[model samples]
Target: MPKTTAQLRQLWRAYECNEAEMAAIGFGPDRIRVARPAARAFTALAETMTRYRYFIRPADTDSYNCRTITGGTLKSLHAYGIALDVNWSTNPYVDHPGTRGPRFSPKPTQAERALDVKAGRADTDMTEAMIAEIESLCTATGLQLFKWGGHFGTLKDSMHFELDIGPDDLAGGLASR
Candidate 1:
């Protein structure tokens, strides 16, 4: 069925949409971007988020991991085709020492900030609520939602989500669990 703005807003609220991440790596100047896989998964999880509301955009291919920021870390969910970042104004995955802004702080400059604000409609920061929504969707679909925020403490890549299960069972599980 078609979704109303209210319905999309409601689902977004439940998933904590207000706390969207500022545009950073993978995300171009436009913050309203999402990967094909993430968008498909998101739609499968909750069509309401996509119904009538076209605020999600497509993210870039490179700069998808947190290793750039932490240096020593495990492979990113993007590497396994289960994760994606949103509204990336800068590369949060990169390690920036002595930086004044927060680890995942929203863009500070006017140009960077403007780019992020403009793209926010289509993209989203992987907040706890967002993660919960993805997890819920994965649970309903029988797909495992593996997150970078789950393992790391210092850096929680909010825009990342993927299936932890092996390849042979990636899609089938979506119907089982």
Candidate 2:
């Protein structure tokens, strides 16, 4: 719902939740934190992943980092405790033909993908099936405001997910709950 980066940042500051406002979801070590407003959606996601036997390791799952984007000046949604990165070890972020150079091809060969993964340039575990399942789950869980970074045109951050709504909307939704 934020129209600009500044607006988004403002929203993040306004609605930024602490650890107590977060919910830990997933099984055993394969867990991640999400804002209370988004707990239900993420819980459902975790349950579905468990039901489908999706692979998500603790070291690869994280949330609520107070930092900017990897290489940009914009504040990350994780700084607001609303973004999550699942299985980042296997769902690496890749840059296409952009500022970071051409590391990702639209249709890459398995060998190329393997090399990319080894070189820390991309991931290999986020298969088409996984992507499809996650997208479908998000659509069905009333998490329409959550955006997947895999949809980025030039940058493929397949491990990332965040609620795209503004602070007021998020607060309102929480109030309704």
Candidate 3:
């Protein structure tokens, strides 16, 4: 069935909505942005945060930036509001350190952060216990609602959660759960 205008309005409201409201409630960033579609997933993602305190800081959460990946041609999922990076300062994209010479994967800033993490400078890094809970929360939907970057073998983006499918797929998954 075709969606009603009211439904469209609600969906658009979700898409263009600002994230300040969530931050006000002590969840995410104050002014961060995400597509309405992604925001729906965010709602489900937040369900498992009750036990995990100190998980996110305003400075560490990033989303909905219109830019390319650190050093790649593909546009970042953030640009499409399909990605969110949390605790990025401590948990970085520490793919093969001192490797991939001359390859522009993460750019210089990330390279430096990766080096720092390898040197054990990441005091705020999320432990496996944290990710384990987060994993349960994100996967609760059963549609593979979110992907934890920490699971990335070489990249190790420990502070990130992102979605690949559309909102309906995520919604269906979340509903089933």
Where's the lowest-lDDT run of ten residues in candidate 2? 99-108
Taking the candidates one at a time, how many backbone clashes does each contain?
A: 28, 0, 2
Off by over 4 Å in 3: 1-26, 29-31, 97-124, 138-141, 173-177
Worst 10 residues of 1 by lDDT: 14-23
Highest-TM-score candidate: 2
TM-score of 2: 0.67
Error of 2 at 114 (Å): 7.5
Candidates' lDDT values, in order?
A: 0.36, 0.61, 0.53
Predicted structure with the largest lDDT when compared to the true one: 2
Rank candidates by lDDT, best first.
2, 3, 1
> Who is ahead in lDDT, 2 or 3?
2
Tens-digit lDDT track of model 2 for 1-177: 324446656766754545666666664356667666666656655665655556567877888776787888766778777788876766678777754322332233444554666676554544455455655543332445556677666877877877665544644342112
Q: Could you tell me the lDDT of residue 100 within candidate 3?
A: 30
TM-score of each: 0.41, 0.67, 0.62
Ranking by TM-score: 2, 3, 1
Q: How does model 1 score by TM-score?
A: 0.41
Please say which candidate is ahead in lDDT: 1 or 3: 3
**Clash pairs detected, candidate 3:** 14-36, 15-36
